[model samples]
Target: MAVNEIRLSRLLRTSKMDDSENTTSFDDRSEAYSEVSARDCLAEGIIGLLLPTVEQIDERVKSTRISQLELRQHIDTLAEDLRALSEKQQIPYDLDSYVKKLVNAKRRVVLVNSILQNTQERLNRINQSITRENERRTALLEPQVSTPSEGQ
Candidate 1:
């Protein structure tokens, strides 16, 4: 399990929520991933990063390229995690995991950048929600509500 996790984490490829563990192509995940809700993608990205590795991330990202077998292993692990999440029924945990995976994912453009943009847009949306929420709250608390009974 650990070895598989490490392999998947290293490859950094587009992950699927379906039966694609045996698949060697990113095109399947990319085609369906965009249609996936933001939360699911973010959650998947997080799991991708949390999985461990023996090689230092820097070297994995830059110096040496991963083999097809390794990439397949990575994809397999991710698919497992997605399957687990589906089974466990845990929703978006946090950004830490997502961000961590994204860093590796970015390093994995040849490896795993397809869903990066989609994941990023999700983060942006979450951030925008916070900003908009703050704005809305500030507007509400501005002490500008006039009492209808004041004149009465």
Candidate 2:
């Protein structure tokens, strides 16, 4: 059995030595054992190229999520700071005007996100807001079911 295996390996090696380029071409069936398929090679190349794109997308997503969270936190801090400012009568921020601006800004966010589905989290935020609005509407429709505008 060992002798047979060695003999077969020698024969295969010799066949490979005689046919280099011809063996590499796809049309040759005898070379199938030694050659790689075009599709497999192409897939490997495509995946190699796509790795960076996928990694970039993932990084962008992580950064966007971090920024979004920071923005919301900053908005909360603004509200608190505004309250403190108003108490001191400094009037740096007009609460009514600032709130009105943010409210409309929220609406614009929704509008832009609704039209642009490719904006993933940007769209997700709008969808979440819309869902909350729907929940509020449903609760309002039923006075005692859950009560509209419940606390977070």
Candidate 3:
């Protein structure tokens, strides 16, 4: 049948032959058979023990693949979220430039207001000086008119 079975059968047949023709004793032949049987049992036991380990390794590989897939999904989700946030933060105009322009406009307004205030102050001073001169001239003319009329 199988190669090992054929070999074992051949060995058994040879062992059963007349002892005078074969120098091997009966005890020696029996001992050899027992040794071969022990080796086969040991080989079978090792294979049986290793089968579960192979299965466990296969299961672990599958689990790792699943975890990797989930991690990839999470990474993709995070990437999408980051992209959305980027889009939301993106503005059509430059905010810093706009703020700078506003600041410049405010400075210009302040400067113009200061100039207007200075001009108004100068005009008020001129008006006050003219009023004082008019008052002095009236005072001088009133005394002259009174003296002239009394003499007439």
Models 1 onward score TM values of 0.25, 0.44, 0.42
> What is the C-alpha lDDT profile of model 2 across 65-140, one tens digit per residue?
5665566566666766766777788545557778667656655545544443355555455446555655664454
The clash numbers for all candidates, in the given order, read: 4, 0, 0
Query: 19 in model 2: Cα distance from truth in Å?
Result: 18
Best by lDDT: 3
Clash number for model 2?
Answer: 0
Better of 1 and 2 by lDDT: 2
lDDT of 3: 0.55
Q: What does the lDDT read for residue 65 in candidate 3?
A: 49
- Say which prediction, candidate 2 or candidate 3, comes out ahead on TM-score: 2
TM-score for candidate 3, please give it: 0.42
Q: Which has the higher TM-score value, candidate number 1 or candidate number 3?
A: 3
